[model samples]
Target: MNPFDRRPTYFFGVYHWRERLRRIGASLSLFGAAVVVGRRGGRLRRLLAALVGVTALVRAGTTARRLLSPVPWALDRPKYDALASLLPLGDVDRALDVGCGSGRSLVGLAPHLPSSTHVVGLDVFDDRVILGNGPQLARRNGARAGIDVSPAAGDASRLPFSDDAFDVVTACRVAHDVPETRRDALFDELRRVCAEDGTVGLLELPITPEGVSDHEAYWRRCLGDAGLSVERVATVERPGFSDEPYVAIAATPTA
Candidate 1:
């Protein structure tokens, strides 16, 4: 069996359904306008209506297709598996995944750890983007995968764990979501919870010019300011998304 062939069973979160419905509604509205305008409008008006309707229909179809297949989200199994591989799982007794959405990264990392290793996942599960009981789904998915993962609702900037509580800490595509005012706090929490020599793995998409200006430089500064030494940085690209690439950074505490 292929290691990355597994399909994600819990992809239809609240946000997913919401987006699907929004698209479908927009498509229907556009089609209705096209029908009404075509009945009594001029040639130019009919052409414009048809174009708008067709465009909306296409967008609706595309959104539906994205939800159906795990391509952009769950299908990137290799990336999660790779991030997990970067950790020292055998030596890690306690692992923490910050912003662990649906336990995808945890499920990928758990198989590599020792049976005695305790894995915990933390997320606010605020449903700001993807709606659903994130923590609940994560727990269910972890159990089905035969991995013992404890999922809980919590803030990333203010971690509940004590200092030096975890041997391994990972945050995938979470840094960008943190507000600028609390970004430093989030990194500090990561450093506080990580052991003296523990590893910190981060996987994030390149900061777009419309977003953060410079992706690499921004992360380097963010990590460096947090007193973490970036040991390595690698890029992962998935075609059809964008020309820009995704970046994964591995760092260790300097203090």
Candidate 2:
């Protein structure tokens, strides 16, 4: 999705500007200082550079900070990345990536969706979704990738799709933002739109205490409440990234 003034907060805490700003400012400052000191090149410059050594030391510090920074640069996470690896890409039909940001996941993983599959990215932030180019590019990129991606504005607590309208439904780190009472409704909506054998993937970054609860058991309880059964639950921890543990929750309709 596109950017917005009143963007609904992301549960993953990716939008926290304070930490992000610190990292960005540090990196840029280091870069700028290095450029300033590196301009005067000479043998004596080397001696002066040795005295200050602003560029190398500062650049190294920034690089290390970026790797360790718990910043969510794109709202993209392992859940989407892992699911993309597992998806039966060909012609994905009505494949929805809930909370799709700027279409990063869609662009990377959509190629694998079936030719018949239409990738729909839904987000509460209409501005980001519009700027995301998800819906527009679905058609533009669909012909080449054999998969279509559409963008829409919808509430995760209650999606607008009809019963059995989708073959694969994916929600990423979105549940953490919804009230506990409302999650069941969201799961139900996800179930209602899924085909009989369709997959419902809940991708989450555990931030809150509830989000960090036993991943498998949580999916069972949540998906089970929606009359869906957990088919697979994979918990993955990516090193040098992701402060929260992630899960790829694959479920299927029980009824």
Candidate 3:
């Protein structure tokens, strides 16, 4: 793929630079160990060296495959698509995507929205967490995706928009990233900017530690805490592309 192919690049801190370096270091160490053991000149040592060398190769290959795969970002297309479908975009005049990294979520939603809709994206654009993340990248990606997006820099906990400013609000895989201390502020902001009767869609990894009941309860509590009523919670699965299951939570500001 072209380095600058106008596609949204949202590799957000999953494999941190430190983590990558550590993996590389381990692989190199294993290779060194194999070399050292192979020179012992014994049948058992030779067998051990072969196994160790193979293990090192497998580890290296696994890391390389993960780096090459379009995971943790590009693979979320199906989730975004499901979210766009669940939202009330038919009559929406404006939409706001909170934490819109590189505008990939917007690209998924743009196709479902009216051409006249004004789509705005807001994010802090911390390049440390997400490589090459910024308003410029979002604009370029939006342009390439054939959608006009207004990308802005701002904090999610304290959005730079007035109350009831947007007809639809969306936060894709963003709620979990907020600091625990600011979770209330972040959700409140999401609800505050949304117009009356407007929808706030959240595509999140399910809290499925215990079971399905607990999972649903977790979301209900989350939305309730934010003063939003849960409208629907549905699963969206994309076989072969994504291994993790995602849930689309649709909510509206409570009366």
Judged by lDDT, which candidate is best? 3
Local distance difference test values of all predictions, in order: 0.77, 0.63, 0.78
lDDT of 3: 0.78
lDDT of 3 at 6: 70
Indicate the residue-level lDDT of 228 in model 3: 92
Tens-digit per-residue lDDT, 171-201, candidate 2: 7767877787787888888888888878888
2 versus 3: better TM-score goes to: 3
- Model 1 over residues 1-255: C-alpha lDDT tens digits? 999998545442544656677878888787888878877889998888888778877877887776554432353566666666666778778989998877767776666788787889999876655655478877876765566788867899999999989998999888888887898998889888888899888887775335677787788677788888888777777565666767777788996
Best model number under TM-score: 1
Colliding pairs, model 1: 15-131
Q: Model 1, residue 183: what's the lDDT? A: 89
TM-score of each: 0.82, 0.62, 0.81
TM-score of 3: 0.81
